[model samples]
Target: MKRYPTVLTIAGSDSGGGAGIQADLKTFAALGAYGTAAITALTAQNTQGVRAIHAVPAAFLREQLEAVFEDITIDAVKIGMINTVDVVEVIAGVLDRFQPPFVVFDPVMVATSGAKLILDETVGVLKTQLFPRATLITPNLDEARMLLKKPIESVDQMREAAEELIAQGCRAVLLKGGHLVAARLYDVLAVRGEATQVFESEYIASKNVHGTGCTLSSAIATYLALGHALTEAVSLAKAYVSGAIQAGKDITTGQGSGPLNHSYAPKPMQIRS
Candidate 1:
């Protein structure tokens, strides 16, 4: 007998269908993984900016996690847009109970349109309670600056930042360098005892990159569920996101930052015995 390689995305909902849970689910389906979600909050936003946010209660969030874990055989997990410390704790507890194989935490601090998402206090809780539980924490340059409380201006600084983030108890860190002012984009991956690795990609000039972080992390989790190792998964995921951006470069979805073409190359769900 065979079953789909399922991934659970414990994140928030985006009414505009660009980022947050919407992007996660879209990436999962595009990469051929069965997608599941336990929403932590709801945001009324578009490609322009966030208007309002309604957080899901901790009890209901726990119920959602239990309901999914009790039924599906989850292969990998992706976490995004956690709004409160309560939601963070609830998710940490549930993850501790289920112990999924892969947990990619996208520490989404700010939206692409310069809107803050998570609270300052919640960031501390996430670092303490959820960092150790996460398989890899993917933070953009700005988020890294918030976490490290310093500047990461150059490639060498990014590598140093990745190492410092791993010291915060996470097993590994993928410090994104999209914000760096350079011709080519670079991302550093630092594992606990392994040597750091750098991934370089051509800088595609496109405004439709609103959900690149959410999409990349979810794609990495999907590749992990599909049996790729950590480094391999990141490489494949970067390629997928680059392709999505290039494919949707000319298309216009909203007045502000648009979204990547997640379904640019859809694949059928994969089966596992």
Candidate 2:
């Protein structure tokens, strides 16, 4: 029997089902990979905003990671929303020990409602421990600005910020430009000592961009698990996300910012034969 490529999400649980582990699993299934998760925290949140967050203990988080690594074959990983410095350190230790083939990190700091998800101290831990281990780090404009400790208001500035992040030990950086003022959306992918790749698409005016960054990173992990090159995985993920945004434009899920149609380019799961 041929086994399906498996992708894992080591992140928080979103009760809203629009982001975090839920979104990552949906994206993996839609992209033809089997999905697994090791939740680091539980968040009581909806489309409007996050109301409460209860973080799991670091030891419990480690147990979850060990359980998956001991049994399942995880081909790739997508990490999001580690709320504390301890949790971040625990995850970093696990990843360093196991070393998954492809790891995509979505540095989720602020929620759609403008509430901070990760504590300030945790950001430093993330930069020092986790960023260097990621195959790709996806940060939106605001998140990038915070990480670089500077303002990024233009394409030129975005390029420079990406360079700075690469210097900070990230293998590659995908600086999302959705927050910039432009008719077209631009995301810059920069790898160390390589030319930057710009991915551009027509800006689709829609309110259904809730979990876009999470979905994109998950999609890229799925494609990477399926043997696609890094550049190809990112390119395909961008197209998939754009289609999902367009598909869910008018459809309203909640009162606030809604989620993207993760199944926009759905593929059948690769069943074992």
Q: Return the top candidate by lDDT.
A: 1
Against the correct fold, how does model 1 do in TM-score? 0.99
lDDT, model 1: 0.94
Candidate 2 lDDT by residue in tens digits, 28-127: 9998999999998899999999999999999999999999998888899999988898888888888888889999999999987898998898998999
RMSD of each: 0.7, 1.2
Which pairs in model 2 have colliding backbones?
Answer: none
Candidate 2, residue 255: Cα displacement in angstroms equals 1.0
The Cα local distance difference test for each model comes to 0.94, 0.91
What's the distance in Å from true for residue 149, model 2?
Answer: 1.4
Distance from true location, Cα of 206 in model 1, Å:
0.6
For each candidate, give its TM-score against the true structure: 0.99, 0.97
